[model samples]
Target: MSNNNNFRLPYFLLLLILLSSSDFLPSVFAKSQNPITDSEIKKKKSECYADIDSGLWGGHCKSSSIAKENCALKCLSPACYELIYESDPLEEGEKDYIRGQEYKYCMYKLSVGESLEGVRGSFDY
Candidate 1:
């Protein structure tokens, strides 16, 4: 009985140690708030536009209009909108239209060999 009790004591101590130290372990699910790089932002913008185009043209959905609207809402970057047009009182549709135009211009600048960082910085706001 004493030998069995000795074995159980070590197991209980190990379990307690593991439980107490669990909070100190590195978390795999942690997210960083670091700003994204210019290239990464550009890649995301391209992907967003592709999704919008696909949603507009793809016939998988019941209504093409609804698909396009949903894709636009999902893909449009609010940060981009805020950065380009801060505190404007435009309606949602108008804002979206302006954002689209600005995005296209940014893409054109990128095609002409301008870095995304430079294009972003060139904007007035």
Candidate 2:
């Protein structure tokens, strides 16, 4: 009887260790199964922009500011919002300069009857 009791103690300790280690095993497997590649993210972003361009949100695609603002709101991820809005950390003066440049560019595009998407591609930010 004593021998059986001693054997069960080691088994219990072993079972506890296995159970505690089980939590880490799923994450290891999950990493391989749940791969979110960059291309997938880009595809989501393109789909988001397409939705915005279709005027589904009651804003015309010709209006750059409105389109950009709408796109930011509808973006799937924070990175997508950054791409559509391009509002990286900037000094106040730099922000003003970039805003002015964007306004001029949008006005020019509008004057020529170009779509906001065209201007979006022309700018780096």
The numbered model that scores best in TM-score is 2
Model 1 reaches what TM-score against the true structure? 0.31
* TM-score, model 2 to reference: 0.33
- lDDT tens per residue, model 1, 2-100: 999998999999887776675544332333334445686568756765765665535532245444444443455454445444454234344355455
Predicted candidate 2 versus true structure: per-residue lDDT over 14-124, tens digit per residue? 887866786765654433443445475567657767777776645654366555544533454443334334564222233444543443455444444445564444545
Q: Determine which window of 10 residues in candidate 2 has minimal summed lDDT.
A: 88-97
Candidate 1 lDDT score at position 64: 53
Distance (Å) between predicted and true CA of 97, model 1?
A: 16
Q: Sum up the clashes in candidate 1.
A: 0
> What are the lDDT figures for the candidates, one per model?
0.51, 0.52
lDDT of 1: 0.51
